[model samples]
Target: MPVAQDVIRHAAERPSKLAACGPGGELTYAELAGKISGAARHLLRRGIGPGTIVALALADPVELLAAVLAADLAGATPLIGDHTWDRRRWSQVTAPVGPVAFVGRPLPYAAGPPVRREPRPEDPAWACFSSGSTGRPRAIVRRRASWTASFPHLSDLAGIGPDDVVLVPGPLVSSLYAFAAVHALATGATAVVPGRWPARRSLAAHLAGATVVHLVPHRLPDVVGRSGSSLRAAVVGGAALAPGTREEAGRAGLHVLAYYGATELSFVAVDVDGDGLRPFPGVEIEVRPEAGSSFGEVWVRSPWLADGYLGDAAGPLRRDRDGWVTVGDVAQPYRPGEVLRVRGRGDGAIQTGGATVVPEDVEEVLRKVPGVGDVVVVGSPHPSLGAVVTAIVEGAPPRALLEATARTGLDAAQRPRRWYGVLSLPRTATGKPARALVAARLADGDPGIRRLT
Candidate 1:
C-alpha cells in the first residue's frame, strides 16, 4: 500500500461520506479522493517524482490537503512553507535541498511529472518551524510513521468520527493544524478551514455546521462566548483557557477539549471540560526524578515521536537508549491512573522574587478579564527580583480589570507586576504567541498602554 492511501482507502469504502469543508465549499470522500488523484496526476505530469521536494504555499485547506496527499502518493517529500515566509529564508531552506515543486499556487514555469520512489519508515516526510518561544525559528522534521501515530489519540480526544465535521482555524503550516487535517481526512470526517480566524467568521462557520472546532483559547472566547453556534466540541491549544471561558463555551453547548502537546511530541495528554488530564492509550509517560519533581519535566516515549529534526542525521530527538524523549515540558503525574498535569513549557517558567512561577497560570487568570482577547506573560529581567512578570494583552480593559483578576482569591505572588495593552499579540506562523516578538515590542517602547515597569 502507498504511504498516502489511508484517505483514499477510507474514501473507497465510504464514497459518499463527508470528507472536508472550508471557505471554498464541502467535499465528500469520493470527491476528495478524486481531487487527490487528480493532483497526483498533475504533479506526475510536471516531473515531480519520488524523493523530490514539494512546497505547498497555498491558503486554501482543501487544495492544501489534496496537494500534500498527492505529493506523498507521487513519492515526493512534501514540505509546507507558510504564506508569510520570508522570501530569503524560503530560498535558503529550499536552496540546500535543491529544486522543489510548488502546490496550491501557480508556478512560474511548466514542467513534467516527477518520478515516484518508495520511502522507508525512517525517511524524512514532514518539516515545520519551531514555536519561537525562546529564539529564532529552527526546522523540525519527522518520519511518516511517527507523525501518523498521533492520529488515534487526536481523533479519540476530539471525538472525531464519520459524522463529525472538524474545523481547523489555525494555519496548516504548523504541525497542529497539519495533523488535525490529516486525521480528519483519514478518519472519513469533514475538515473545515477558514481563510483566517476572526470572531464573527468563526462563529458563522460553526453555525453553518462545524461539529468539531480547533481553536486557541484566545480565539475561543470571541467565537463561542458571545455568539451561538452548532459546535459540539472545541479542541483548544496554543494558549491556556481562562477560568470562565471554558464554562462559557460549555454553556454554548461546546465541549472544550484542552490539548497539551508539542511539535516534537504530538500530544502528551488531553482534557475535556474539567474532567482532568489523562494519557492517550497510545503513549507512555515518565516523570523525571529530579529535584522539585512535581510532574516536573515529563519524559515521553510514544510511537508518534518524530524521527529527528530535518538535515541533522546525528539523531538529536532520540532518548537515552531507554526510549525516553522530552520536549522540555514540565508535567507532574496526577492522581491515581497515571494521569499527567502539564505545568508549562520549561523555557517559559519564570523566577520571580525567589519563587519560580509558570506564566500559564497567570495568563489563564488574565484571559478571564472582560474585554481581554488574548494575553502573553513573560518574565522581564529585574535587578532586585531577578525576574518580574510582565503581560501583553490583546484587548484593552478597565483599570480595575487587572487588579480584579489578580485578586483571584489567591496570594499576591500569583498576580502580574506589569500589564500593557496592544491591538493584537504577535503570533507565530501557526497562530501561537511569539514571546520574543512581544518582548521586542515592549523594549521598543510601544506607547499608549499602562505598565507597572
Candidate 2:
C-alpha cells in the first residue's frame, strides 16, 4: 500500500489520534486525512495526475507533508523543492522536471472529483534533490516500495510506535528529516516539526511529548543541553557525530543512535552503542580493496535502493551488473556484517606527499583536542607535496595543543601542516561542513582564516 493510504487507514481506525503538530497547530488523524484528500482534489483540478510532476515549495512543514501525501494520492510524483532557494535557482531546478503546477502554499479546497487511482508499488512516489555540496544537486527519484520496504526495519531500529511522537528539527527538504516525518506518519506516530527551519525558540517547546528526535550532529550539542526528560532517543546523521557530542548526549540521558547512509541508499547502517555502525536488517554490504589502499570502497545492496537519477545520467551513483551500488565511500569491515568503519569518501581523499589521507580520519583526531569545539580537515595547496593537509578549527586553541594532539593521534602524512582558526565554518543546509567551499576559501586566502602554523 502507498504510504499515504496507510496514513489514511490510521485515520479511519483512530480518528482522534494526533497525526502532526507544527506552527500551524495540532491536527488529528481524521483532520489530516481530510486535508490530504482536499489537497489531492485541488491538484487534480490543476491538471496534476499520473505522469505529471508537481513541485511543492511550501515553508510550513505541516502543509508540505500534506501536499506531498496528496500528490501521491492523486497519482502524481511530488518533487519537494527547497523553500530557501531564490527564484532563479528554484526555476533552474524544476525546469528539467517540467512539473505541471508549482504550489508554494496551501491550495484552496474547491469541491472536485475524488482521486480514485492508486500508484503502483514500483511507481515513482516522490523526488528530492541531493545536497549539492560536492557538485550540482541531482534529482533523485524513489519508488514507493523502496521506502515502504524499509519501514518495518527502521521502525524497529528506532523503536517508533503509535504512542511515540517524533520531532524532526531540520527542514523538510532534507532526506533525513523527510524520512523521519514520513516514517512517523506511516507508523501512526505523531511527527512534530518546528514552525520554521532552525527553529528560533528552545527545542523544548516541540518536545513536550516527543520521545525520538532526528537531528544532525552539529545541532546535538545545543539540543543535548536543553532537551526535555521525555526525549529518549536522538537519531543523529547527515554528518559524523563527534566523540565529545556523543558523550555530552549520554550525560544528558539521551540515547544517541548515529546512522550512516547516503541519498542513493537509505539506512545502510546504524550505531547503537557508539562503537561502530552495523548494517540494517536485510541490508548487505561489501568492501572491496582499492588500488594502493587497505581501506576499500563500500558497496551496498538493499531493497531500499533508489531507482536512479531523474535524467538517468551517470553521477555519483555507480552500480554493478548484479545491482550493488556505491557512492564512492571507502570503509573497512571491523567484524564482517557486525561493524564497518567508514574512512571517508573516495573523492574526499587528500593526497599529501606520497600517502593518501581521509579528512574525516584527521578531523576525528582534531575534534578530541582540548578547546576544539568543531573541526574540518581539507587539502591545501603546497609547493612540493602538491597538496598539504590543513585543519580548520572552530575555537582558537594554542598551536602547541593542536600539534601535540596531531603528534600522538595522527601519522606524519595525516597530521595537518597548517591550522586555521575561525569563529564558524561554512555549512550545508543539513549542517555538514561545506568542505568544497572551505577549500576554495583557503585556496583564495580568505581573510578570516587565522594561520597558526
Candidate 3:
C-alpha cells in the first residue's frame, strides 16, 4: 500500500495545485501535504505507529482528512468515530484497538520518543463504525492500499480532475466521505464539505462552482429544485434514485449516475452518460440468477476490496479464493452486456401479509404520489401478518388520497396498510431517512406522526 507519504509525494511535485475547499477554506496541495505531515509528526512524537487506532472526533472536513492522512503516514490505523459520538461511546469503540489520540482536543506531550513503523498492503488503514444489524455501531475495516487501488479511477472514470471542484455534503466519519476526501486528494481536486448538509446551502456550493457532487437521491430532488447550478455530473448513491428524479436531472442538463457500491466495495459499479450502472475497469461482476428482471445477488471481485473486518469472527462480506465479495446488494440485469439494475438492499426487503415487497420499490411509487412531498415506506411489526406495510408522508395529503394513488401503483399485498405523516423524516448524515429512527418515532406515537395525506 502506498502510505500517506506517497500521497504527499504527488503533492510535493504539484504544490500549487488546489487540494481542498472545506469549512477550513481552500488549500493548495502543498498546504494540505504540510498539515498531514505536521499531524504525522504529532502522532510519531506520541509513540503511536502501525496497528494503532486513533479516534477522530472532530467535524472539520479538512482537519479530519488531514488527521486520517497523518495516521497513514505514522503507519497507524485511524478509527473514524462520529464527531457526535459521546466520550463513553468513543472509549468503548477504541477499546479493542490500542491507544487513541483524540484529534480536536489539545494533547499532552509524549513521555517517550517516536516510534517508526511501515505500512503494508493488508494493514488496516481506517475502522469506520456503522449502526450494525442490531442498531449498535460496529467497525467496518479498510486498508490503505484498498483506497490507493481506486485512486487512478477517480480522475479517469469518475470525471474528477485538478480543475474539478468536488463537494461532498456528508460527515467525514462516513465511509463515502472518507472515499471522496481521499479521492479528491489523489486527483488534486478541490473538495468542498459542509459541517452538515444544509440542502439549499449545499446546492449553493455547487452553483458557486462545484462540478462534481456526491449526494444521496433523497437530497438530489431538493437540491435540483433549489438551484439552477452549472453542475456537469452528480454521483448519487446510498439510496435509490427514482426514474422521475433522473429525468428531472436530465432536464437540468446534469448527468445523474446511480452509483452502486458500499463501504465494503468502494466505487465498485458506476453508470455514466445516464446509462445503467456498470463495473469499473479491473473489477469483475457475477450475477447469481442470470435471469430476467427478477433481481439476484451481486458478487464482486476487485483489486480494491478491503482486507477484512477487525476482530470480527465473520469474514469480510463475500471474499472467495478468487477475491470476489458481495455486500448483499440485490440487482437484476438491465441491458445485455451493458449494466445491472440495482433493485434494493437485500436486508431491506419487507414481507407484508405473506407477500414480499421492497420498500425502495414501494417508495418509488410513493415519490410519484401527487401530493406527496417526501415519503418512506417501511414494514411496521404486526401480530397477524408478520409485518404490515406503513407509509410515512411529509407533504400535505388526505390519507385516502395518498392510499388511493399508492394503490394504483402497487399490488394489493404490496400497498401500505398503515399511513402516517410527519413534519420530517429522521435522517443519517447524508439526509437519507434512518428506518430505525423513523420506526422509533412511530412507536413513540409522537404527536408529530399523523395519518398519511
TM-score of each: 0.69, 0.75, 0.70
Q: Clashes per prediction?
A: 17, 0, 1
The lDDT of each candidate is 0.66, 0.76, 0.67
Relative to the true structure, candidate 1 reaches a TM of 0.69
Q: By lDDT, rank the candidates, best first.
A: 2, 3, 1
Candidate 2's displacement at residue 126, Å, is: 1.7
Query: Model 3 misses residue 178 by how many Å?
Result: 1.7
lDDT of 2 by residue, 1-453 (tens): 667787889999999999998877778999888889888888788788877777788888898999889888888888787776666777776665654467788866656555578567767887776653122456788888888778888777767888888888767776777888998999999999773334435566766567888876656665675735488788887446665778888888888888988878887888888887888777789987754444566899998888778766445688999999988776764446567877664335564553457677788889998888889888765544646788999898898999999999887888888889988886645577756556656655779888875
Which should have the higher TM-score, number 2 or number 3? 2
Q: What's the lDDT of the predicted structure labeled candidate 2? A: 0.76
Distance from true location, Cα of 116 in model 1, Å = 9.5
lDDT of 1 by residue, 33-90 (tens): 7777767777777788566778777767667777777777776667776765556657
Query: Order of candidates by TM-score, top first?
Result: 2, 3, 1
